[model samples]
Target: MQQTEFAFVLPQGYVDPEGNIHREGVMRLATAYDEITPMRDPRVQRNPGYLVIILLSRVITQLGSLEQVNTKMIEGLFSGDLLYLQDFYQRINQNGHSRLRVACPHCEGEFEVETVPVGE
Candidate 1:
């Protein structure tokens, strides 16, 4: 079976009003509709950067113990977490995996490292 969901741990995480920090979450592979619908969002139209806000919310199916992930919740995330999610989204969607190819500058050797560890 194909894997459609990816698990992640935010660097700084999201803090709720009650003062709880959520670092672990799950983001699923984005579909064509997920990418297209957000482009039509008024917020995205107003600020091009907001496209990522909506896009991440749709793809992040779960965030810590949250029942549902939404745009407002996404907006509450720390800058580091947001940036991490953006890179994660690009990695999974574009590369079809969370591993990154790296080269050792000293030895000129190459290896792949998992950005988001699978199966926890």
Candidate 2:
């Protein structure tokens, strides 16, 4: 079966009001609706950057211990974690894989490496 969901870990993680940290989460492939609908949101219309926040909120099915993931939760993520999730979303949705292409400067060789959380 084709994989529709992917697992990811944040670089810094989101800290909740209770001082709890959430790092691991799951992101699902974005459907046409997931991509298109966000553009119509007033927040996105006001600030294009908000599109990612809305888009991410819809596709992220789970985050650490959170029972439900929402736009507020997404907005609470640290900048580093948000960046990590953005890249992760693109890789899984656009590339159909969770990896990044890298080049070795010494030998000028190209390599594909899995993208994982730091210190993992």
Candidate 3:
């Protein structure tokens, strides 16, 4: 098997969304809070904007086009609906390739990541 270097690490303005990656202190605090309370809490690490968000963002950096990125991020995270995911996957294949499939180590959730070629 041939090894290929990663094409994209992060996209411009990606850090703009969350400002920066969550700090170690923030992660520790969130974990502690989740353990202590275990109630519906925003501080929990599994919150919408937590680790999974970061993981997905990194995945988007690897896409070959914007459609895959948009569909994977917008449709998957916000909608969590299968129809949208399938459509996105089909569209990516239609473009002559498929996106990288990233599965969460903690959860069974498998998602796609794409790296879009930047515009001129």
- Pairs of colliding residues, candidate 2: none
lDDT per residue for candidate 2 within 21-92, as digits (tens), equals 888888999999999998888999999999999999999998889888889989999898888889888889
Where is the poorest 10-residue window by lDDT in model 2? 111-120
Clashing pairs in 3: 62-114, 62-115, 63-114, 63-115, 63-116, 64-115
Comparison by lDDT, 2 against 3, better one: 2
What TM-score would each prediction reach against the true structure? 0.88, 0.86, 0.21
Candidate 1 has a TM-score of: 0.88
Model 2, backbone clash pairs (residues 3+ apart or across chains), number: 0
In terms of lDDT, model 1 sits at 0.88
Tens digits of lDDT, candidate 3, 4-118: 2223222222221444421111001112332344334353355644433333333333333232343234333323222333343334434434356779999979988773422
Prediction-by-prediction clash tally? 0, 0, 6
Alpha-carbon shift of residue 112 in model 2 (angstroms)? 5.1
